[model samples]
Target: MERFIEEELAIAKSVDLCAVAEYLGYTIRRVGKYYTIKEMDSIRIYSRSHWFRWSRQYEKGENGGSQIDFMRVFAGMEVKEAVFWLLDFAGYRRIEEPENRIVLKNQVVDKQEEKKTFILPVAAGSNTYLISYLNQERAISKVIIDYFIKKELIYEARGYHNIVFKGNDKAGITRFASMRGVFDKEGRAFKCDVAGNDKRYGFNDVNENSDVLVVFESAIDLMSYMDICADYESNKLALGMLSDAPLETFLTEHPQIVTLRFCLDNDEPGRKAAVELMEKYYQNGYEVEDCPPPVGYKDYNEWLKATKLLQRVPEEKAVMKSAHGMAK
Candidate 1:
């Protein structure tokens, strides 16, 4: 068994907890002076090496500490394993000492790392459940859903019957996919990206000849926008998460795109990202616009539901009036 010295352990503990959380696929967001995880807001990252889970504090009694504790608790790693993983994450390698002792050493390598192969989930025999959920529950139009289904951009996955949204590269190769649950649980639908998803290739509907791009936070919201504006001709992208990696890649691939419209959610994090991205891309010389959902709506889907409901009111009233005239 390899053992680490106190100094080596200290270095491992000093690794940034926020970076570790992000690397583990948890979304971290800044709230006031501390950082909070998006999926589990009860946990707060106090500093580079310190964190605590408020929700577990009373039940578990002092439930967090340095990066070591974070890895052990959240990542389910052993003490020595956590230390080794942290050292590796911080770019340090283990040097074997005499009698099974391990010393941390900074080693540099010039070789490029191999890329992870992206594999999509197995497809369901048919998109029956997917089409019903999106069309009936989400209020997304069948015309729009059928269009994307025909393009091979949307499908139902096997087992869970998740709605899988695929993202393709410039050569039209699927490099990323995100899944949304067909059914809601506890008032929230399950959402997650597929393993080996390349954030640089976000789920998108691109018009190569168009010079404009409209960005959204999720694939459903992108499709919602399509239903709202049937005549829209510009490119559309869903980041899958609140990061600019996909936007950056899209811009690099399509040099013709000059205008950007951000349609992120009407929430704090969404607004903050929109502001930052708008300024950053504007400085890069692209025309940028902040086009969030209308007031009182949380997202484009919510807005679409309201718009659809209002459109049916007049028809409903007409039916009632016709029945009353017949009775008279």
Candidate 2:
């Protein structure tokens, strides 16, 4: 048990206690009370609350603390237990003294420096970087592009440089896309590059006064839905959560939207965010609808691509509806 405390403390310090708690499905408070044994160095039995207090107290940088002081006060372990815990957590057989271990604490700092170069935040807002890669002539060859165009999922923009979709074509719609590239603060082009999670773009076209507004998980899915409703004319115009900040800003500054249909991502993050968004906006009269993708697919884009039924959508509205119903 003492060994467990040391190992757990090492992990807790390496990551945050909150993250560990989330992953382990156990609380720090409960773990402290159940697993702690005796401390070898301090001969003190530290309580859970006191350990947390010590963590907060010595948080920034403080030295000259004994090994027992750290384990008993900070880790909530007894002295005999702290020794074994440290040994087990550090993967060492034993420790003759506690103060020597203090000098080795800088290792985590080095690891932090290493991680800094690997991870980067995803870019938000407009992505015009794909412009250079756009081959208008070859775009027709891309099956996805052709599918949307044929179904009016996207309108042909002769001068926009790349294919652009309009949000005004439908009502109560949600949309999505796996767009790549980066954008500027003013919601305009910044650079052109290959697609990556490095950057992203999002937008919204829902009216606040509307009784129903649909939100899609990705821009591609939104476009697919738009193409599906191209003939209907009165169908919903979907927005993506990538557009959430913008939509919230718009709603806050102007009219408050009411009904909302959230076509959330089937993944964990999307589902969690959907719940949070629903909680945040539901009281404001914004009703959310869940448009889950078909079984075995995470979203509608995949559904459309896998099924290859977009080829059947004729340019005419009535014909498209008939085809869509039949395909479904």
Candidate 3:
């Protein structure tokens, strides 16, 4: 037993991670300096670079570790069991033979080390910048915006004056953050999902008195829903996932929620996610429904704009006439 364990340990220490994954039915969906394995949806393995350092495809969650950890996580096996199993596939494949492998793309490879890290920008003096942008420019209701700000869910970054929407854990620590530039934006269409955010801690506004939970794809949409429905149902809980990644986590965290309303975007991806999440929760014995953004509108924010009943986004830069400024 001791000799077997020692041998397995030695083999696991120098196993070919990519080959093992391929042999075990994990197809490489996206390959590059980082390889995205099918088995782990949001986990990227840094192949041909570091010894066994992999990073979570997710920015907020800690879903990363060494090759051994990869086996344990994806295979659902114990440490010793993984070590033993990996030994058999240690010499499974090699870095060459790209012609026959790493499908879906024909990009050439020059093996080099790369690392990803998440560092949240500094917060500005107060929520003044964000409040002005969302209320005056975006047309989101002041009452709804003020409510979230008071709850500490949204803020403004110091240098950029961007809007920072937080995904917080049970302990109230900011695990994930979604940032959109209110001014002085650089790239990605004025939006960025900062790394190191745990989707499990997706943005939530819970009202213990209410059993209905409405979910949205972005923070602006969430606030828009609240704005439109401000006449009633103020107690309904709202969750802004920043993306669909946190839908499961948010649902899981709120089992007491009897009604799950997916108020996602109206586009293909949004409808797809809403359908999936609705089915998943409905199967779990909860009442689930997907109410996508109204027809002729791409998102709730847009829908809100067309209504003109609520505080509407300014049609011109005449509104950016404030220190907070406007998107257009």
| Steric clashes per prediction | 0, 32, 6
State model 1's lDDT.
Answer: 0.84
Query: Can you write out model 3's per-residue Cα lDDT over 1-328, one digit (the tens) per residue?
Result: 2434343454455544555576678886656567776655555656421123245445332366655676776678877777666543332111233445546577777876554465776877788768877976667878888888888888888744668888765566777787775532111125556665555556667665567778877778878888877724522333444344565565566556788787888888788877887887788887887787778999988888777643334643445666346443
Instruction: Show where candidate 1 strays beyond 4 Å.
Output: 1-116
lDDT of 3: 0.64
TM-score pick, better of 1 and 2: 1
**Candidate 3, poorest ten consecutive residues by summed lDDT:** 88-97
Q: How many backbone clashes does candidate 1 have?
A: 0
Local error of candidate 1 at residue 229 (angstroms): 1.3
TM-score per candidate, in order? 0.65, 0.35, 0.54
Q: Which sections of candidate 3 miss by over 4 Å?
A: 1-119, 184-188, 231-245, 309-328
lDDT of 1 at 216: 97
Evaluate all candidate structures by whole-model CA lDDT and list the values in order: 0.84, 0.41, 0.64
- Ranking the candidates on TM-score from highest down gives 1, 3, 2
How much is 41 displaced in model 1, in angstroms?
Answer: 43
Best by TM-score: 1
